[model samples]
Target chain A: MRAAVCIALAVVAVAACACRIPEDPDGTLDRVEGGVMRVGITESDPWVELEGGVPTGGVEVRLVRRFARDLGARIEWVDGSEEELVDALKEGSLDLVIGGLTSKSRWKKDAAFTRPYVETTTVVGVPAGSSLPDDLDGVTVAAELGTEAEALVDAKTDADVRPVRDLGRAHGEPAAAHDYVLDDLGLAAGTELKEDKHVMAARLGENAFLVRLERFLLGRSEEIERMLRKEGRP
Target chain B: MTDRRETEGPFRRFELPEELLPEQRKAVRLEWLTLVYMLSAVVLLALTLGQSQAMKAAWIEDLLSLLPPAAFLIASAMRTRDPSAKFPWGFHRSVSVAYVFAALALLVMGAYVFFDSAFKLVTAERPPIGVIQLFGEEIWLGWVMIGALVYSGLPAVFLGRAKLKLADELHDKVLYADAQMNKADWMTVSAAIVGILGIGVGLWWADAVAAIFISLDILHDGWKNMRASVHDLMDARPRRHDAREFHPIVDRIEDELRKLDWIEDGAVRLREEGHVFTGEVLVVPREDDHLVDRLEELAHHLLSLEWKVYDIVVVPVREIDIPSRDGRPRSSAVGEEPARSP
Candidate 1:
């Protein structure tokens, strides 16, 4: 009986050691049990979306889901546009804004961005036989306002820019109004949105947390990329 | 019969001029050296990983995460190049460049660990040591530290041995130097294991101190080699003063040729072609009646120096002034006797 008691005590000790709260002196995990992680995500096609009234598919969505799992927390996804995602993150309603966010100095005040997982240069696509335009000028170009693509267009050309609400519309929209659509890595020279690389953002003070989380995520990124490749872009 | 042969018979001779096969053989050895270095590192690392207080075997594994993939990339890149119009020299140096890249990766890895540990040590932040039960014995990480030594040491020995052979045969300086670096790394890994064990025995600063020393050593070696490989790629020449040994042989050849009564003056210049030396000698012969036969014979004789000279070109100068001695025609002494190799 005494031996049994000692074994029981040792087992208990190991169990207790396992459960002791992680001394995250870095405060990497923003919330303990009750702390809700308000994750602001864009409802962009292919990369993120809401399915059956629950958080669903997209590259960033899946990436963040795995991150949440590692942090031992539940994610409450808040739907919003990229601009609204930035605002939600800034207003403190969201703990992290996940989507195709790129690192820009202008967003320094609103949200902190993680190290770039993928870097890409802009590419222009045209109808199979159509020649690619030399520049965006004298052409109808589509781009989301305040995006790197739009900034590139503004800096590189004198074209009459058309603002599009979504990436799909920007590419799927008729090219008669403009020669091309500029957005992130993909340019719709004809009528298709090309694939590009983007980033995820969170509030500034969460820098340490995001940095560590990014590193952890990057280590397991092959799996995340494999999942993305399996599920074609939305 | 022996005297007759010695006076007017042929000398038995064989010279293994490096061909495609021997070069390919050296390449294979280089690949093997790279593999041995990597495997030994993994094994030694596996041994010492458990000794550290914070980073368990798994953590060390994670830290070592990038080495294999980067090494694979370099190995693959070397196999991708084919002979092209733009690159007629072939991509032999690509192999050297790839090796330099591997060294750079190792250096970067060392730096990353050193900086991270130094910051932690300075802040007095003691990392949590995770204890695991192995083979029914409660083993502290001290054993893992010793394992690291074995992991780094064994492969180093293999690489050093192979590299010495490869260097002597192929005359590849980079591979030979890298072998020395690997030997040094074995010592570093051994030191790191000792430091980690010291930490396990309650000397907290031991592990970090060891890491700092190892990092500095790896950084210095890596930086020096990377710079050299880059210099070679830029087609830099050896300093003029440094060419003294070979310079004497070329000078003596020209001096002997000038003594020839039938020759006016001989100008010689030397250049390296791969692992051999080829000299272009300009001779102003007295007449052109037997010019072709004489120059060709002279070229053949110079190339007969199997160990030192590989190829020779003899250019006959038609019109050039000669310093007269008693109004006698000067013939090249070089055509009469061979120049000694330095």
Candidate 2:
């Protein structure tokens, strides 16, 4: 009886291993590996930018280009609004969508999201060449109203948080803004505050595609940071 | 003064019949063991629940599996309690009550899961079970799920075998029902395996199909156990653990009573109170001399019949309507004992 049970278990194990490639629900892996890689894009600046109604220079654009080249597939970039692109992704007309979507995007329920490939950190920074405070305990920090940076500065530090319309016009006070804004606002980066994790979306049930895409993103974390830095520079 | 008997140290009780004490001890030990092993299985299956519909159903089933063992243990504590001022009939019926609760849990959850799986089939929901990162290597999550399922399922086969033996020896309906559940658990695990493998091979509806079968198994166990326990509560004749067939000892008691010189006819009426029997033996006496002494002696002799004949009374009746008592005509409760020959 024991040997029979052992034999049964061995049979089960062997049978499971037989499916070498966990078959995709929609055959996304087989189609996109050597054929047209259908990419949908919307205007989310610094990740995807529309130039003359076409997708042009952005960090995600660069990543998608490399991904397509590596898979030996031709890229077919379809430019549309976010809603249109997401609808297209639903119908399987588009393989993936990239537009600075976060891990917590509303589209999360409608599609499969890759693990956050990049985390954009927010920090309280002083203008360049100004002495960095040991702590923001007594400092006044300016952040855009109704933004995560405003909430972060209020919670993380004892600074007098000043909500502003924009940080573009320099407020001499330490400003709570995204780390990517350091060069644009001429601020020396300081203590970090909040993080906005950015992710890419794919048609749901395309497990093989999602896995491959996530693997690519995870394997080249540093490369993504480099592109993010260059693309976000104002 | 405190009264306690400890043949098996943990399954503590007071003043059980000498013959049945060991069987009760063995049943209690097996039940405790069931709780320990099932606890492990529930935890293991929970960790591997991942995202498979079949795994979720199996995990929930394992979680609920704790109910019967726990109910048995709790009822065992109450089953042997002496009759109190408020509850003058003793707590012997606790086991039957516990059996109903466990069976009801199975039936209700089985219905929910069955419909849930069927709904998934109708909606064509594709289960998105994919690869997971383990120590920097991507492994198929199905392998881990199946491993946990196998671990959860295999032990029940052996455990079920042990449980059925004890169930019969102890005359425990709850244990018998739980044993049946455990015996069929392997089918649930095997069906889940095929479902997971089916998903691996890109058949989306297979997991839901397997879940339907698993729920049906649970439902069948619940229905059978519910019917038996309800019959017992209704004061139906004491049945063997296998159901329908009356316990042979019920007839044996009647045969023992008829062989005496003073009895012209006798009919045994017995109802199960948990693991023991309690009812009256109706007899028509042939002689009046030494009648009281003889009936008392008969009751004592019936109590010693290698079973938990905990409470029985031999009454001298003018006539025992054999067909009525033995057939579908008698609806009298244990309360009416023929006024004890006015």
Could you give the C-alpha RMSD of every candidate to the true structure, in order shown? Answer: 15.9, 5.4
Clashes of 1: 24
Judged by DockQ, which candidate is best?
Answer: 2
Candidate 2: TM-score?
A: 0.80
Q: lDDT at B252 for candidate 1?
A: 58
Candidate 1 Cα errors over 4 Å, as ranges: A1-234, B1-37, B43-84, B99-128, B234-342
What lDDT tens digits, residue by residue, belong to model 1 across residues A1-234? 354354335334533664322122334354623355678876664457676535668777887777777677788878777788787766556778876566553664456565556543443333344455566456666666566556555566655567666555555432322222232223344432234445677654343345445555554546655655454432
Query: Candidate 2's residue-wise lDDT over B1-342, tens digit each?
Result: 111222465333453566767887887898899899999999888766765778888887887788998888988889877677898778889888898888788888888889999988897766666555678876767777888888988899898999898887776778887787788788888888877877776777878998898888878877887788789889888878778587888778877976786787777878888877787888777788888878777877887784566667677776554454356654432334554462
- Candidate with best lDDT: 2
Residue-by-residue lDDT tens digits, candidate 2, A186-218: 787887886789989888667677777777777
Question: What is the fraction of true interface contacts found in candidate 1?
Answer: 0.00
Docking quality of model 2: it rates as acceptable
